[model samples]
Target chain A: MYVTLKDGIHDPQGKAVKDALSVLGFNGVEQVRVGKYFELDIAETSLETAGPLVNGMCDQLLANTVIEKYRYELIEK
Target chain B: MYVTLKDGIHDPQGKAVKDALSVLGFNGVEQVRVGKYFELDIAETSLETAGPLVNGMCDQLLANTVIEKYRYELIEK
Candidate 1:
């Protein structure tokens, strides 16, 4: 699951990123926001099965889905 | 970053796992704790450089480090 700040949201971490960029001498870096990327293991045979399982995981467990917006991609092991 | 509850810690999510298992008719499943696994894109030239950067990311932003323990692996793009 990749979790990020929705557009126009206030992000303290993103502000910190801007601060860091200035310190690092990277100019013209206007904005930055932090997000989370998650990889989960599912006992599914393929992406089709994994999709619903992962979505359930997100809806029921992984993400709040209300305050945060998340998207995920399944990778085979 | 992989974020998980410290050993012996109480996890509400894990309890949810237990509940789900029972609902799913899976017997003898005593415990389960969900964790966060994150894959990040780095601009580093090598793992050596990426390691410190990732650790910095964990410390500075990604994981709380104080409450949740986290570890990460970098995948080249």
Candidate 2:
């Protein structure tokens, strides 16, 4: 699962990126925002098992109950 | 950029999920892991501009200097 700060949230990391841009001489840069990513491995071969399992992971662990939100995609290897 | 703990690292959130599963009567559940996600809107129209810019965002802010790793994909609206 991947979790991130929802839109309209203050992002300290994004602020730092803006600051770095000015330092790197990248002028006219206005803003930045950051988020999270995840890659998961599941024993199940079907979405029926994977979807609910992953969603439960998101609700229980991948996302912060206070501010951030989460989403995920399953990849088959 | 989306950032997450490198594999083999202990994930506290994953641990919590395991705990929750047991509470919720999911006895066979073994593990859980979490990560970050981002959706970016860029003024640029090409990968040449978007790629470096997004990477800079990742290195400067989106990812922690220690423990986590990150990757991202571009989405067009």
Candidate 3:
């Protein structure tokens, strides 16, 4: 699952990163947003079934849906 | 740049997140590895130039090359 701040949400961390880049002489950088990515190894065999299961995980704890948006890519191993 | 724990590098945070998922009843989760994702808005027009610049960022501070591997995708806006 990929979790990122929702659009219009203030991202102080992102701004801090941007400021750091600027200090490093990477003045070309206009913005920088940081996010969390999770690679989940799951027992489910198909995405169709795992979708809701993982969604529930995110809804419950993996992400704060009110301020963060999340999406997942399921790959069967 | 995406920064993640190198294989064979112990990830305590990942373990903690996995444990949390297990407690939350997402038993289907076999493993969970967390990582940092950065979206950089840059002034450079071509990846060829931005590539080295961003790589410098990662090499200098964005990632700990000894225990973390980083890769980036260049998207034109």
Candidate 4:
């Protein structure tokens, strides 16, 4: 799952990174958006059951939907 | 680029999310690791020129080599 700040919300951390990169001589960074990456291990193997299960988790906890948006891709293990 | 804490560093945010998920009765979440996801837009187009450019950025600013490790897949836009 990847969670990112919404378009209108400013990312200070990303701005800092871009500035620091420029100071370090790595240029041409037009834009940078920082986000969260989650690698999860769950017991449910079937996508049918797990999709809603994980989505429920996201709704209840992982993402703060008011200011942030999340997208996920489930890969079978 | 996906930047993650090296093993044994312990991820408090991940643990907190897991505990919250359990409290919400979302079970079977065995493990969770939280990391940083960076979406960068740069001027360079060719892989040959851009690979090292981005990697240098990671080495210098994005990933703290002391405790975090990073991997990236170059996707042409």
TM-score of chain B of each: 0.84, 0.81, 0.94, 0.91
Sorted by TM-score (best first), the order is 3, 4, 2, 1
Clashing pairs in 3: none
Interface RMSD, candidates in the order listed: 6.4, 3.8, 0.8, 0.6
Clashing pairs in 4: none
Candidates 1 onward: DockQ, in order: 0.10, 0.30, 0.88, 0.91
What digit string (tens of lDDT, one per residue) describes model 1 on residues B1-77?
A: 56776667777876766677557654444455566554444455777776776666567655666667886656665
Flag regions of model 3 displaced more than 4 Å. none
Q: Quote the lDDT for B1 in model 1.
A: 59
Which structure among the candidates has the greatest lDDT?
Answer: 4
Off by over 4 Å in 1: A1-77
Docking quality category of candidate 1 according to DockQ thresholds: incorrect
Which tens-of-lDDT digit does each residue in A1-77 have in candidate 1? Answer: 66666667677876766677557544444455566545344556687876776666556654666666778766776
* Best prediction by TM-score: 3
- Cα error, candidate 4, residue A73 (Å): 1.7
Model 3 lDDT tens row, A1-77:
78989888888998998888778887888878888988889898777998989889889988999999998888777
**Candidate 4, B43: how far from true, in Å?**
0.7
Which 10-residue span in candidate 1 chain B carries the lowest summed lDDT? B25-34
Q: For each candidate, give its TM-score against the true structure.
A: 0.51, 0.62, 0.95, 0.92
